[model samples]
Target: MTSQHEKNTGEFLGATHLEGCLFTGEWKPRTLTAPVMEPATGDQLALIALADPDQVAQSAQSASIIQKQWAATSPAARADILAKAVEVLAEQTSEVAQWLIREGGGAHMKANFEIAVTIKALRLAAALPEQAQGLVLPSVEGQTSFARRKPRGLIGIISPFNFPLYLAMRAVAPALALGNGVILKPDPRTAICGGHVIARIFELAGLPKGLLHVLPGGGEVGEALCSDPHIAMIQFTGSTGAGRAVGQLAGRHLKKVSLELGGKNPLIVLDDADIEAAAANAAWGAYLHQGQICMATGRILVHESIARAFTDRLAEKARAIKVGNPVSEEIFNGPLINQRQADHARSIVDETLSQGGILEAGGSGEGLFYQPTVLSGVRPGMRAFDEEVFGPVAVVTTFRTEDEAVTLANMTDYGLSASVFSKDIARAMRIGDCLHVGLLHINEQTVGDDVVNPFGGVGASGNGATIGGPANLDEFTEWQWVTQRDVPTAYPI
Candidate 1:
């Protein structure tokens, strides 16, 4: 029987041992290598080949060649291939989820959920080709005019470590379905599962060679992809700072770019909200996967009348969460991605406490593991209230009026997602409308996404472009207007 390393090397990389980037259907080694470590154990899992600027250029050129051919292929064929990819992904869900848990430091349930969402995204992308339609325009009596969607050639996808599979496929599936070749630069931390696993699945689904390339590395590789002229567009998911760099690079090249960046999302619990239900959703939204999600509830805005009750229940729920090994089925909170993140979370909590915030639940753990923490009496000046803490810490702030709640919710530079929980649908909707976020949830958690809905943000969160559903196709394609006249027309001159 093959060991884990041997199996990953042979099956995933097609080499005796994992070596380098998968460029244009070939496994090529790089001069430099980065070590991929398991966050939970702090053990080196493998060394991934880091792609330099020259290698990034080569991958872009090759993708350009393949994209032209793919774009010329029939839409029906593309849709069919995407449909087959869904089946291939479904078969490997368990294996992929295991990789996510080990490499990404995610809970088992969270990993599985990521895989499930990826499958749904694939299915949604499969139907896009058939549903894609152009519009007829009114024209002069003797002329006809219309617009059609055309592929944008090569798309460069830079995905984050958290929810790597789902984030990568969120762009990959749609780009492929729309007949565009993709160069995927997954996070160096999740190269094995996010980059290697995805490449293998697409190959099994019968995607033509060179159409999908996985070049796993650090920021240098992403910089190369973003700056390459051959790459027509870039779809990125990461922190606001990183997204800013990507946007700047893409803008310099005059290329289309879509960014799904950081979020200091808020969850508002109105006085009329069910206290138990609000607390439960808050726990799930803020503590799931140790709160590494971009849309995790960073701030909880509760009505003054119920703030104490809500904070009490939220603290109780946080204390009960199993914070341990990600592989354990009973565990809900897992380790952060690395020591730095864990340290960052701790520092944030300490700063909040220093600023006169109350720590009601937990504030201590070992190594990369951080306990689920709840902070009350958090004010605007506190770091926990103003900054995005991508950890299992929920900061609660009390507001006396609905206006104050909306003001508090929209008080951050980040505006990715927000949730309003109230028994009255109209009241919840009113609050949600006032929050300056890209996605708003009513009577639900902020950490939620649908494959058929537009997923992105505004302000510092991201650029205006979106991913998922029909928007996916729109993001990867351009419109071409065609006009025809049966008879010759006279020139103005």
Candidate 2:
């Protein structure tokens, strides 16, 4: 009998070409190519051409040249094109979702959810023109002064492997909607869905040639794009180390950059909270997408009074999740992106146990699959508590007072997102306000996000620039001040 993963792989192979990169309005092969493998079965899916420094420079130059023409086009026309692109995305949802699952090693539900969220983001981006309102300032008599936003010539985007399509469009759709050209470099592991699929969709939607380009490659290509003179700004989503490198390089060039980096987010469960509901939410936040998300909750801070009950419920929930092939709808936790990640996750669990943390349930699995793990008695100095374990693992620690909970939650170098759960809404809101994170949720999970909300991080998480919502338009644009006078003024003596 054919397995569900095999069936999905066959459908993807039959539907799309396995090679080629998108240049300015053209599909072409490069001198160097790399093979992309299916993480679940370790099967070679396709070869993607790697863009070199020269190719990245060329693409950046093309985007700079094309941005002028794109900026001249009316905003309404651009919105229409984006709306059509959304329609095209809806039409190709199943194929693209399958590609995401095969390449990124995410479950079926996650793949479909990513597509739906991406489409919604594009729709929100379609309103950028109207949302980018200008201001008129008071001026001296006979003089008029006002300010409006203008497109930065070209933007370079570097997206990660997890949620490839959704993260890519978070920057791409808004840049295009704001009349700026973009050159995107997706992670080599997910080139098919992030580069090829997106390129094809925009082309079929009748977007002007040269306005959007997809270059699939490794770090060298991303470095080239960051340093390219033609590119005006950089928008990146990835690990903290990579983000630091990109941010430093962009800083030397005096170019604007936005980064959405890693997180060791915390979820606090008060004594008055519903134990079952809190456990379910914590499990979802920690184990969804196999805990690969930037905002995945790595620490669960529970009041000492309810810690045992909460930990028991969470452990039961974790044990119930089936870990296997992502293409199967019955499976909840799929394999990590690759073997190295699995080893890292395992090591973290091992270190936690060695450091006196007790494992409540699930500490091992086969191949790239690390079973969903629950740990208790985790302290601030433990590896699992301090570092980000980007796998299906959750660390639980007990806190006695609100001050202790807040302190324990803010103990890490990351401050990306945090969640507070309590029966008292007012108290939850108060605690949420005190948590030092870019995003906070009251009586909810940490993994949720909306397209219309400003979604980025603070401290080590990002550079304070917000993505999504109306703020995204600002990231891709600059302000131009205009002043007019009826009569020339004399120079001061």
Tens-place lDDT per residue, model 1, 76-135, is 998899999999888877767777888888887888888889999999888888874678
- Candidates' RMSD to native: 1.8, 2.7
TM-score of 1: 0.96
Q: In candidate 1, residue 194 scores what lDDT?
A: 74
Candidate 1 lDDT trough over 10 residues, lowest sum: 9-18
- Per-residue error for 203 in candidate 1, Å, reads 1.2
- For model 1, the superposed segments whose C-alpha errors exceed 4 Å read 1-4, 7-17, 21-23
> How high a TM-score does candidate 2 get?
0.96
State the weakest 10-residue window (summed lDDT) of model 2: 11-20
- Which residue pairs in candidate 2 have backbone atoms (N, alpha carbon, C) closer than 3 angstroms, thus clashing? none
TM-score of each: 0.96, 0.96
The superposed Cα distance between candidate 2 and the true structure at residue 314, in angstroms, equals: 0.7
**Please, what is the whole-model Cα lDDT of each candidate in the order they appear?**
0.87, 0.87
Residue pair clashes in candidate 1: none
